[model samples]
Target: MRTEFDFAPLYRSSIGFDRVFNLLNNAQRLHAIDNWPPYDIVKTGEDDYRITMAVAGFAEGELDVTQERNVLVVKGGRADKQEGEYLHRGIGSQSFERRFELADHVKVETAKLANGLLSIALRREIPEAMKPRQIAISSGLSDQTAPLQIEAEKQVA
Candidate 1:
């Protein structure tokens, strides 16, 4: 079965979400799906995530993890070997390309392979300026003067 995606409606909506519309319009990126070596994305902690991919026959040297422009790419390819006679060959060795979408500010922490599973951890740190802050209220009017209007001064400044 084949599936087609239409991004015309998204562009016509004009809901001020240009980022989403632009992403949808980029067909080259939209069609890139990782089907080889099934994987899972799990949220382990606050702002923490882990991506586990099943690479049964792939070795550490054959796999590579890299981040390019907010995209996590994992590629695996076995080294070429001379054809040898095998009476019973059950293990399958194939090359694959996997891509993952990462949000702004999200970065790859580390990657490790163990027990045929390749685990990649990611973390995002919220900027201090973007975090919420509590406002302090004055208990009473000061002896010199009451609360002065700072908006006018801010505007002039």
Candidate 2:
């Protein structure tokens, strides 16, 4: 059983949240129930993050990692190859793609594969102009007691 949410009301009242609403709508539409090759996300630091996925039977050449705009995509699979028949197969070796939504300014730093794990490192690099800074408030002419007066008596015809 599943339920769908209506975001029309929120769109009418909210501002500067179009992305959020779009993400919610996309999530509802995808509704993917696949959970193979389990992964974990962790906040390594204030501006750093990490994603680790367990891919027991995959190789470096069979995986791909890419980021476009605010989305991170990780795909794993290998080209079809004939091999000896196995008496009993236990490992999961199938094509899979995982997507991650990243906030603004968040970028992928590096990706590493070791033992049976794939680790992706991310960092938030906000631009200098976007980072918060102290503003200097100044007391302008408002503090002056006398108002300026124009002297035009000599030029009067």
Candidate 3:
């Protein structure tokens, strides 16, 4: 089955979003029509994630994982073998391409293959400046101020 997406109305209404619209206009990317060696994307923590792909009959050496231009590309291809006399060949050993879109600041931490599963862990770190900080408020005017506020101001500066 094939699914279709219409973005004409969205594009028409969108203003000052040329970059976004251009990305969406890429039909090839907007529609991912292939699913081989199904995978899963799981969020393990507030800033951590994991992508697990079911890569049965695929060896660790046969698969390759790389991040380029913020896109995670997973590719698999089996080594060629000489044809032998066989009555049946049920299992398939074919090449496949799987792509994933990543958010800004997200990066692949590590990749491991175990128990027929290819798992890639990702982590996004929040910069110290971007992290949430508590602000202390004074109840009344006093000659001496709260130590926390002084520390906060120093950090900000």
Best by TM-score: 2
Worst 10 residues of 1 by lDDT: 25-34
Residue 111 displacement in candidate 1 (angstroms): 0.3
Clashes of 3: 0
lDDT of 1 by residue, 47-146 (tens): 9999999998788999999999878999999975758987987665678888777877899999999999999999987788988999987765554676
Model 2 steric clash total: 0
How well is each residue in 114-149 modelled by candidate 2, as lDDT tens digits?
999999999999999998999988688657768788
How many Å off is the CA of 80 in candidate 3? 2.0
lDDT of each: 0.83, 0.93, 0.82
* Model 1, position 17: C-alpha lDDT score: 81
Off by over 4 Å in 3: 1-32, 135-157
Whole-model lDDT, model 1: 0.83
59-135: candidate 3 lDDT, tens digit per residue: 98899999996689999999868598769876667899887777667899999999888999999877789889999
Candidate numbers, best lDDT first, in rank order? 2, 1, 3
How many residue pairs clash in each candidate at the backbone level?
Answer: 0, 0, 0
Taking all chains together, each candidate's TM-score versus the true structure is: 0.70, 0.85, 0.68
Best by lDDT: 2
Write down the TM-score for model 2: 0.85
